[model samples]
Target: MNSPDSQWSFTAPLSAVPEAVNACLDQYFADSSKEFGSIGSEFGQAISYLKDFILLGGKRVRPMFAWAGIRAGLEGGGGSLSVPFPDATPNPKALLSAISALEFIQACALVHDDIIDKSDTRRGNPTTHRKFEEEHRQKGWLGSPEHYGISQAILTGDLALAWADDMLLDSGLGHKALHKLRAPWRAMRTEVIAGQILDVTLENTGSESVDDSLKVIEYKTASYTVARPLHIGAAMVGADPQVVDMLRRIGHDIGLVFQLRDDQLGVFGDPVVTGKPSGDDLRTGKRTALINLALHKGTESQVKKLRDALGVVHEEPEINDLRELIIATGAEETVEDYIRIHSQRAIDTLTAAGLSDAITSELVALTTKLNDRKF
Candidate 1:
């Protein structure tokens, strides 16, 4: 268990992540460009778009979690766990390559998610599908701009997904470590797809049950976003089964808190901070926990207003009215309480894991950051 006075330092600074991941990404694109450039300039253009989309700003949360997991595994191997500023592991490059694969997976998801949500912007920039759509319009393309955009975006996501596997396979981990990666990697991919299907189905059916929403969270966000990344990292080091189980459990709770925060931000966070329009989730008719709670508790008129506002274009005043209705029902507060509960649950799990103090401190800090983040 971590003591009260334990000290922790992040082995790699968050600022270093972009540089490290971009190096690998740039190499992959350069190699890909050489091979695909012979095919056509269109392939080059698509690659460029993927490059830009990936290099654009993100929190790099998945990679950070993986890094912490690596450190945790290292610490569990009978060392003090506190090391110097750099070179925290035997093969920093291998770890970076393995973890950075998460970014490509994330890019694939966001690209497809933007298409599904009809989101115009991500990280304060035009989304991948929207970018292609605008390009098609500007070029006066022969096909429907929307169709062109969706088609190209789907292909781009496929490309990213393929490249993610390539990156992981080529990450220079031993044959055994790579073999260990297969289960979690496969599970992560399948679970996120299943979750996405569930989410879309729920939206179409207008189901707003809390149970359904939580199911989405568990399969969609929790497993892919946090649990698998931690598991993969722990696998990279061949950590003990008990340790891996503890990390997965901790990740489950933390992932829920992360998604809960994201749901709150969708309704209430600033566009500048969250990089999406206000009330975007409401507009998209996402069957989130907050929405389920509102539907369950809201008055008849309030429910009617919410139902009407969903899945439709709404003016600012109408959106604000919906927001007020959600808040008035105390759904926002209810979700907030869940966030607190999950956050503490995660901390408690960490405390009981008997991990090194330094690793525990870093995980604790991550939990706090995720819990309190506005974005």
Candidate 2:
């Protein structure tokens, strides 16, 4: 059932979601730091790094999509042509806090992903594991700094997941809504891990087929990043099953394009802009669709170049040669085309989801921003 106060006193402008969600995260961090302060100075310091890793900066894509889905679900619940800010919801802050949990899940994903990928930096800051490793070195701690770093980062990721569940429960969404959210919430966490496992397995299997790459993104990125967040909101508001399904469908395609854009940036983007070295994906031997297509479409020599350099090349010149091969093989062009087409298809589905034009336009804008991102 919808909340007693059907309309919030104020509606959040679309521009306010990131800021609002950030505020929630800031508050949570403050409370958490205090609650966990008694553990130990070393533990306290570790928490600080985890806090900074999360709050330093982010695009807040997951929370924004969660809020967007809430908006859609609110409309669906009311059968209204337009949504009032959080109509049929609990307290504005409460509901916002509930959705803001997505950020914590995101935090968990990023920290663990860095560990798995052996990434040095994220958004121009040291990755969590790297930060911990450096701390161990600086303090002359009594263990392998690399091993210490990974262990701490793993715990940090686990803490973030714990905090996510707590945040949702404490957000005052009420038991009924929380109960409804259980499936989506659980599914999101598991799917992301499953996807990560697939990603790791792919690196070893050396399968660069486009289908294989797509399969990895299907669970690892699309579902966790977009679809499940949307599903969470829809379920919370008890939207029609059809609307929920439509959202899931749109989220999948949109999520694909989102990651596709990320793959492009991983190779072609400037280090300063993208916050990672160019060709990082190639260095890591990620079996991205871009790599798969290049392997499939390239001439024998061009294919051999990618296969040889992938997971091995480090020098800029070698990376540049690989970049050229990707472009020369037309794989980059194909990925660009996929991003455009899938983004449009997702938008088209959103347009038909019986939402008000304003809501639809905002979601479309979000999709455009995601695809058009340079970083």
Candidate 3:
């Protein structure tokens, strides 16, 4: 067994992920450009937008989780944990392609999400729709610029969704491996779409129940973001059924913690780091666990204040008051405690799986990095 310290020694810097994934994306685009012609050609603008949006910035967490799942699955087959180098496995290229597909799926989600949220920026750059809106205004296009932007953004997101499937099909996995991947792949897509619908419903209906909020988290963020990716990787390797189930459970816990942290950051994080104004969630009236707790525990006036602030962008001082109200109600601490509990639960699940040292160590490092992230 590798010691924890030694196991963690292999944890690659997060920065390395974008470099690796970007190379894959560049090749994907190069081949696509060959078939589709230049950026000015038919459907080329959407392709270029997706390329830039995906390659520009993201934590690349889903792909990393998928890769880790592959390692974990291989370990289950009694393989050696110390491989000495990356992509040294039997089916390295296929695995990388499959993993890279996750980013395209994520791109689809984010583009559609930005449209829904009416967000202007992502990763410190203009969102796809917003960028198109600006283009319409600059070009003096005929239709309403806002409508034109929405239409183009929708098409771009659809292109990403379609390409995600294409990438996976073209990943060079055997027929059997591809067959195995279908279940998780289809389920991931379904869950995210259902989750998005529920989220929009809750926002419109003004539901305050923690249970409802958690349901949204489970489908929208947790399953799509973590559990499904892990399962897909395990499927890619034909891992033991029991091992796959274990990863599903572990991924669910970690994914929930991941979203909770995002909710916190959405409200309290620095704009410079988070790449959005503080209290964006509050402004959007997203029915997060934190908000639920605040509503449940806050005084009547505080509840009123919160209700008033929800879905309406407020000035800094009002935003500060809302922040203070949430903090004063002790919701922040309670949510933090919940995060701690879930984080430990996930670690405990991972430890109980008795995975090889390398897999466990990487997962532990990922959990720590995710839980402690400021953005």
Best by lDDT: 2
lDDT (Cα, tens digit) per residue for candidate 1, span 130-244: 8899999999979799999999999999999998998888876666677676898899888998999998898889787999999999999998888988887777777778888
Models 1 onward score TM values of 0.90, 0.92, 0.91
Error of model 2, residue 365, in angstroms: 0.5
Tell me the spans in candidate 3 whose CA falls farther than 4 Å from its real position.
1-16, 38-42, 77-89
* Residue 197 displacement (Å), model 3: 0.8
Query: Over the stretch 178-255, how does candidate 3's per-residue lDDT look in tens digits?
Result: 777799999999999999999999988989998899999999989998899888878877777888898899899889
Of 2 and 3, the candidate ahead on TM-score is 2
Give the CA lDDT, 0 to 100, for residue 22 in model 1.
67
Worst 10 residues of 3 by lDDT: 1-10
Q: Cα miss at 193, model 1 (Å)? A: 0.9
Clashing pairs in 1: none
**Mind giving the per-residue lDDT tens digits that candidate 2 earns over 1-375?**
222133332245455677777777888888888998888898787778878977788988887777777778776434221222243444667668888888888888999999988889888889999988998899999979999999999999998889899999998776667777799999999999888898888777867779978988899889998999888877776767888889899999999999999999988988878878877887887878888899999999988888988989898998998999899999999999999999999999898778867668888998998999999
lDDT of all the models against the reference? 0.81, 0.82, 0.82
lDDT of 3 at 338: 78
Better of 2 and 3 by lDDT: 2
